[model samples]
Target: MTTSRLARRLLRPPGVYAPQLDTRLLLGALRQEHLVGGAELLDVGTGTGALALSAARRGARVTALDVSHRAVLTARLNARRSRLRVRVLHGDMASLADLTWDLVVSNPPYVPSPRARVPARGPARAWDAGPDGRAVLDTVCDGAADALRPGGVLLLVHSALCGTDATLRKLEGSGLRAAVHRRAVAPYGPVLRSRLPWLRENGLVTDEQPGEELVVIRAVRV
Candidate 1:
């Protein structure tokens, strides 16, 4: 990540997890592809406002939404700190107001652990994606088509262990042509690893799968 990006991430409130590599990578990709610029953008699950701020910096009119009130406040504070204009709202993906965006990006809760431990101060809607880890992703995939304008794009991040194949299928089933634009493997972290057995028992993970690796999937709304 560039120094500016790092600074922006660090400016977020203390409780928010600083933007991760996947978030930076997606933002970089958006800039490289010229997919964002003076367009209306919506960021779902905009924790710490990484993607939202990045888009705002790139001249996009951004609306960032999170189900957690703290996250919304944190994101708004972060946007002000960064001196970027972004409208931060507290809402779920499905309940977002009727508005069309030229680009939609989200780093949603795709962890598949049944008992995933998250920061007590963090938003439950920011983590915990249900047993299969597809709850939030499913909502985004289903809602994106209607939320985006023609030739609009939707970028998402998730874990490889959470059935990447099925995720792509769901996106396609929702009438969005999707692709894996970037991927990286990192430590699964202690909390997700500790809940592995429960995840497997609940059919969230397979016995053959290891407890690491997250896949960042970026899709375009056709």
Candidate 2:
């Protein structure tokens, strides 16, 4: 099989978070970094290991983290099948305290839900963040500076509905220089389409447009 076709086929298994436009979007920005092969990289919330695998393919020393058991297993399988050495771990950012990386990338659970608290299990755990959609995003921003080496870079992607300005302010407050590196409009997926009424009711969506703006935030620790 051709490389691209094989890559698409090996991407995900049942019940794992499939790589979507957000994943592709992050990878797109990553390519712009012109990262050296030996760079230490971390992929947080690494669904299906797509981003992690991409970096590994480019010769990065990659460590991937996911809260879901299935995602961890899937990522490991993909890594092994592709003959790449990715350290797949099952935990959140708190679990990586002792290690530091030159670059950290994440496509976290940023969908705003009606619930006040985040889910611990089930498919919702992959995407159903709290009401304002910044639950896990906040968690990552809180410790990203500490998780990086000096001069490290953190690349993260999420919806604009979660407040791009808020993410920038939080990262900057934590002592990192941050900015929105890219923005793209994506058609609402099943999750957002189902929440249209609730989103509109909450004023998260101002018009009938069936699209959401996604922003890739890049933060650097100097």
Cα TM-score per model: 0.85, 0.94
Model 2, CA-based lDDT: 0.90
lDDT of each structure? 0.74, 0.90
Model 2 clashes, total count: 0
- Top candidate by lDDT: 2
What TM-score would candidate 1 get against the native? Answer: 0.85
lDDT of 2 by residue, 26-124 (tens): 888888776786999999999789888889988899999999999999999999988999999999889989889999999999999999989988888
Report how far off residue 104 is in candidate 1 (Å). Answer: 0.4
lDDT of 2 at 149: 91
lDDT of 1 by residue, 121-192 (tens): 444445667677777777887788888887888877777766888878888887888888777666567657
